[model samples]
Target: MAGFVNVRRDVDDKFYRYRMPILLTKIEGKGNGIKTVVPNMADVARALSRPPTYPTKFFGSELGAQTSVDEKNDRYIVNGAHDATRLRELLDAFIDKFVLCGSCKNPETDLILTKNEMIVRDCKACGERTNVDMRHRLSTYIIKNPPPKKGKKSKGGHAEAPSPPNKINGENGDPDGEENGAGSDDELTRRIKAEAAELNADTALAKEDWSADTSPEAVERRARALQSGIASLAVSNNGGDDDSDEDADSPYSQLGRWLQENPGSSAIDVFKKVQELGIEKKHKAVQVLAQGVFTEDVVAEIPKYVAIFAKMVTSEKHQKALLGGIERLAGLDYPDLVPSIPKILMQFYQADVLEEEVVKTWGTHVSKKYVDKETSKRVRKASEPFLKVTEHFRCTGNRAN
Candidate 1:
């Protein structure tokens, strides 16, 4: 059996967070009728979060071949004797342009049809939104037959929704009619509802604290971490007093608090505030600024802050502080998004907020200065795929020299 492969085969295969089945192609109907049947197209499409027809039509668009979709039968066909490797390569191209987020490179995205008939990729991973290239022929097909709207409730409401008739009278006018097995279905539904009610009545699980620590003390600790952590790291890096007491109204703390309070502030507004605080000259301020400015949507927000960061992160040490801030943000605040650290780092690097050498150097070692040791290690492990690529290129360049 052909096991699964990473959705982006270009990325490290060991990374199993995003994966899809290997393309399996079988040639059938020899001669002009010959076609390649993708038996597992539905599975692969499901993994990529795309309709099977999109990739099926994509294959036809790229190969200049006729394609057929048997959605009811889970069959997708592309005319001609094409090999699996060729189809897989084309699929990767499709994934890059259509599936992955243009900013973060994460594949957890959806194709949304706009009122103007354009399609946009809405990334769930980092909340990045970008327009799909309409130049491709598949775009026309996708626009015409867009993906179905998910999780939409009917305006009629649940009570107004149609259900099968409870009974259908036979020649004998029987009240317990078995038409379409309605009687058995009703019994099964009653059993399920009773079980669900019992589960809902279990108050212990519901009362348990399943969410993050939002108690007053926990909140105060988090506030302190935000206010003091970055400055301590920066001071420690500079061979200064790491144990020095910082007031609640210190410049860095003020910047962090302001960013937390007014997250929707524009880059120009934030830069203006930074100037007002007279902290623009302090590169260490970049650390606290980054930690406060971004939330779960850090990847998407990077582009909008490029101008401000270009001013703040002027040197390697500043870039390191930026990375440290991101570590705290992802590791401590948003642990669920830790797997996206590589994409987040890439977004920063692409925006010129962090230097490539600085990212490579930071990824090499896990430091507890920004976050706890375990979290720092986890973040670095998540980043290994990106780090390894940069290391490979550096080593190759050295060999060529």
Candidate 2:
């Protein structure tokens, strides 16, 4: 009859032991699923047709043992003390089929029984050491088991995998639903090209046949189409109205002609046209016309015009035109320019103006805005400590005194 032992190593490097007998019996419907089961000494000895032995040894030694047999279950329990080498060999054999590191999945490892009451194993791959625990070993064994075979496809053919849960909006719909915000760059480009094609067809039809001096209905239809073309171009360029030098006969020229003819048109109409023109073209036109013709009447009607221009400066597309406009006004000392200065300075202070070129340009205009002596002095003082630190470290030798 085979025997089993339960052994524990104590802090004093001594082994405490208990013993039992191994039993074998056919468990109906539990063939391959049989797991190692521990039984008490009395039951184990009874199963083994042997008398129970509590705190008994195979021979006479400090090593301890206990034995039991269970006739009813046909099982036995054997426990005993073991030396480090013997315990290691038993543990290695018991855990041989499942000793992989859970985290790193390293199979090759050295078993280390420590004096500090830890059975540690070091993984060769990831250099991670883990304690040998029964729970961990059992879990690793279950994880290593192969998955069950999948069933065959149905007669209707293989069903599609269910769509993953939608993170945004959480609507239970097809993943290929309507796209939000700006569509993909390729899709946008395709749409723009298609729209441009339609616009070109309409423009060609108008030029070859219908004249603006013809019927009022025809003229109105043409104007509407032209307006749409301009709007489409403006949105495509992100409100940039500047035309490149390469395109000699640009859309802006057509829009500009329409604007000049319809001088009494609404601000919204003008704004739409302005949005259509390339950004540089819009700025150039606005700068020239605003100063010359924006007159007292126009300024009163659109008090927000200067404010809009100041806001436009924040945009990358219009930054150069905006900075140039500011510099020109600062040099000419334009009367209406003072009110826009505070808004510009606040923006400049907030923006990432770190580069030397940007700083130099900003420094020239910044001093002009700081007119209040006390406020200017306080601002300088606040920055002095940081300046001093930089100077001390020789990062920038010049510091505000």
Candidate 3:
């Protein structure tokens, strides 16, 4: 019989798709020297998309015992008499903290160490990059032994696949099992020359784009070549995925385009158009609507959009989604929008859209979806006013208990 279960599902879930092998622990030794051996740690770690040594080290750190992972024998051992039940409980904590994404609770995430040495999780499913909690001892270990760097993907979809090596049997034989090798030799030489010519042409074009001659004629030629290359590369990168832009066909993109096209459109008119066009998700619409509606006087207009925000954050799920979008929309793009975000958030508080729990969740991490690192930092800095409101509620014992 199979002996595995989904890490975060009910123990009785019969058809849960996400499964990891059961923690098979064998307690060995007696009296003063006791240890638990996890014989299938490598398999478990493979399923969890983590290095086996991480969990091994985590167990030692948590249990206040020594642990070792013997790669040669595929053995993971922790000193002490631990049971499957305790280890399973520990696994839940690990999954919650390190495995699942904070936004979507999906396990499809990669642990990234940024240039600032901050540990973060990049959720592949939702495109949310969240900073990891750094208070735990395991966090220290993770920082020291960070995951390997992932290759950069082309904007199309995934990283470029390497060109396959050409197969040649110059010394031994021909693929057709020919009795004579004379004809095959001539064919191979012709093929090599054609391939070399193609490579030379590509090199010449790339070199032309990089030419830095300062003469007037040469400068014009260089500019034309550079422009052509950039245009081609941009088209290649954007061909596969629907990268966001002002011209995209998505409802959010249409809203942004319409806003830029019709700056004088009334709020009622904008809302009507949004309804007629049909927004797929209100959370995403928040970002588009913010970008389209607000200008230098965003603070004065916060009340105008209060009804929209109220509808967006009506439930806990909506609150998380809307906050994620807000982290991007109110991010750092609008210097005008930045100064007013704190007051906008306070309105959320007064409207009960941003409850105390939601506010606490927003402060948990820096989001990197709609904004860059520095921009996100600025947005969070501008949000200090909302923090005071939440703190006031917390200090006065008005937290949602």
Candidate 4:
């Protein structure tokens, strides 16, 4: 464990085969120009079978800072000065979410974007296909920039591991020694070189020298932190259900009755009634209007109400509530159309009922705030395909310009 650590630091097995280099970070520049650079990001990314940009971008997203990727130079930077320990903790968070298999907790997973646009982690170790939580901001990044499809095949027909020509340390994969001052033979530089060399080495010794920490309390602490992070995604509620009670006096009921009374009412008429009822500012009004205004053909009917939705969705909270409305519309009211969520979302986006950032945020994680846990999950899972394709188009469009 001199230059490497167990992939699953919680598993205290002395013989754990999966290992990766210790994360090394260097703080560069001063004041407003300060940044944290990971010189050995390529080596660590290789060990995880992911693009170096992923963890770099994840760090930026979590820190609310900008990130820069220098694949050609083997340098990844996150703007603003940060401590190495903080970055290491964030790296652990990344590994738990993206790298380790959800079933086996091993770093032997392949990210596959499905036809429906959902990202699945296909674990080679456990034979399990687990869906990645798309609610994370990093999911958009992964969708935009997928990992290289497959490794190159060697002469023997086996796919050789990727060997990037440039390493932070000048020896093994390093092309130029001057970048990051990696050419100097200082103790830290030598250690980084050794770790980089170990990444490319396929010898049996490298596989055997892995260690883990088995302390139950330590493992529990890490698990609690991760759980807390996931729990934070959900908004606070008084434990009331999303749907309001139906009564003759209820504003939602009044609106529903008005909709039923005026079958041919236009979006403007609906807006007038919504304002008259004093429920236009309520988030749940979006849900009520979605159910009341649309029929069995919700997808076809969505275009008719885009103007109303635009007027109603005046804030981020309203946008989220609109998504919640769709969850209930498709998930509870018309379960049959749950499969058509991507189409539904596309229509919403095209109609300006939803913004790209809001949809991306909603798609990343499933929350009980919108509906019942199972129903919300079903809705978000169905929407993944659309989210993926949307991100892909945005990325390609940027490059085309």
Task: Tell me, by TM-score, which candidate is best.
Answer: 4
| CA RMSD of each candidate after superposition | 22.7, 31.6, 24.5, 23.6
lDDT (C-alpha) at residue 132 in model 2: 59
TM-score of 3: 0.37
Per model, how many backbone clashes are there?
Answer: 0, 29, 0, 7
Name the weakest run of 10 consecutive residues (lDDT summed) in model 1: 154-163
Ranking by lDDT, best first?
Answer: 1, 4, 3, 2
Across residues 1-401, which tens digit of lDDT does each residue of candidate 1 receive? 77899998988859559999999999988755678999999889878877788899888767655578877688899877888999999999999989999999999988876544457999998998898876565764564345645554322111112222321112122221212211222322332233334434357544544344546776565556555544454334362313222666777767777875565576667877886876664555777777777655566566456556644554566677778778878877667778888777766653435555678778878887777789888987788876665444332222100
Off by over 4 Å in 2: 1-266, 275-303, 306-314, 326-401
lDDT (tens digit, per residue) of candidate 4 on 132-212: 866565764554344445668432222344322221221222222112211112322322232334343476534543333
TM-score, predicted candidate 1 vs. hidden true structure:
0.41
Model 4 Cα shift for residue 393 (angstroms): 29
lDDT per residue (tens digit) for residues 280-299 in model 2: 22444443223221221232
Give the alpha-carbon lDDT of every model: 0.65, 0.32, 0.56, 0.63
